[model samples]
Target: MRILMAGVSGFLGTRLVDLLVADGHQVTRLVRRPPRGPHERQWTPSAAQLDPALVAEADAVVNLAGAGVGDRRWTDQYKQLIRSSRVDATSTLAITIAGLSEADRPEVLLNASAIGWYGNTGDRVVEEDAPPGEGFLADVARVWEAATRPAEDAGVRVVRLRTGLPLHRDGGLLKPQLLPFKLGIAGRLGSGRQWIPWISMSDWLRAVMFLLARADLSGPVNLVGPAPVTNAEFTRELARQLRRPAIIPIPGLALKAVLGGFAQEALTSTRVLPGVLNRAAFSFRLPDLPTALHAALHD
Candidate 1:
């Protein structure tokens, strides 16, 4: 399959590109800068500038474009950047796809979203069908997902990937914690009761490919493991894997001081379930926390 992708330099995007290439799929990346290689095409999403022929030539378009939510302190300005980065990239692609004739349009659009949509669910289990929740991330997610409306209305199959925490030692949620865990200083956040919906890096890549091929599936799909664990359970399992003790808990106040607005999201409990994938009978390679964490650290 010929796949056109945006945000190819990101954590998930980088790995996904490698996996797709390994699987013999032709992948072209959309870049804001000048093209560095034949596989890259230049486009300024902020200005809605892109070649329509690029969209028309591809079999599918996968957009993973967005500013890193936790990359910086969430000042008012940074918050706006987070929202604009996603909405601009998505709107650009969706609008471009919508402009194409039916014969020229790509068959499917796999857009990036987040489980943050179901914000602060506490103990309530949320699936893809759950309505948008309250909070900054949730509000951003709502607008982010809605940006794909143009493509959807154009009859393109749209899959909004409401991704959870993908565990990997190289990046995502596990990288920063590894050093502290190895030093035996890591612990849970707040009361450690917050439910964390996590998936292995392997499963996340595989799931994207699965959804890319599944013609019958569209709309929001939760890319999470079958089993969800609390913050304390995750802390214990991670420490056990590293042969370290996790007893010193980090207070939420400390997190707030360090992470700024992102702290609230870090402590937010989102017990997301992969209802769409489960219904489609998609198998997870690492379905449990222990197995997933081990793979993240060791593999």
Candidate 2:
């Protein structure tokens, strides 16, 4: 399959590109800078600019473009960037796909989303059908997913990937914690009761490939593991894996001071389940936290 993707330099994107290439799939990257190679095409998503012909050449389009939510402290400016970065990229692709002739449009669009859509679900388990929750990330996710309507309405199959925390030593949820955990200074955040819907990096990559080929599936799909763990459990397991003592717990106030507006989100309990993937009979190699963590830390 010929796949045109945005945000190719991101943690997931970089690995996805490699996986696709290894599987003998043709991947075209939409880059912000000048074309570095034949596989890359320049696109300015901030300005809603993309060549329609680029969209015309692919069997599918994978949009992983967005600002990193945890990359920096959430100042008002940074918050705006977080929202705009996702909305603009998604809107650009959706609108571009809508403008194309039916025959010219790609077969499907796999747009990146997050489980943050369900704000503070507490103990309540959420699925793809759950209603939108309240919070900054929720609001962004609502619009972010909505941005794909243009393509969806234009007869293109659109899949909103409401991804959970992907476990890996390289990036995502596990990277930052590795150093502190290795130093035996890491512990749960705040109350540590919040549920973390995490997936292993290998499973995450596999799920994407599964969804890419599953033409019958569309709309919101939770890309999380079957078992969701509380922050306390996560802390304990991580500490055990590293043979570290998780005695230093960080207070919510400290997190707020450091992460700014993102602190509340960090403490959010979104117990999301991959309902769609489960029903579709998609198998997960590492379905539980222990196996997922071991694979992440070891591999």
TM agreement with the true structure for every prediction: 0.99, 0.99
- For residues 1-299, what per-residue lDDT tens digits would candidate 1 score against the true structure? 99999989999999999999999999999999999999999999999999999999999999999999888999999999999999999999999999999999999999999999999999999898899999999999999999999999999999999999999998889888988888988899999999999999999999999999999999999999999999999999999889999999999999999999999999999999999999999999999998998899888
lDDT per prediction?
A: 0.96, 0.96
lDDT of 2 at 295: 98
lDDT of 1 at 233: 97
Number of clashes found in candidate 1: 0
Clashes of each: 0, 0
In the range 167-282, model 2's lDDT, one tens digit per residue, is: 99999999999999998888999999999999999999999999999999999999999999999999999999999999999999999998889999999999999999999999
lDDT of 1 at 114: 97
- As a whole number from 0 to 100, the lDDT of residue 126 in candidate 1 is 85
Off by over 4 Å in 1: none
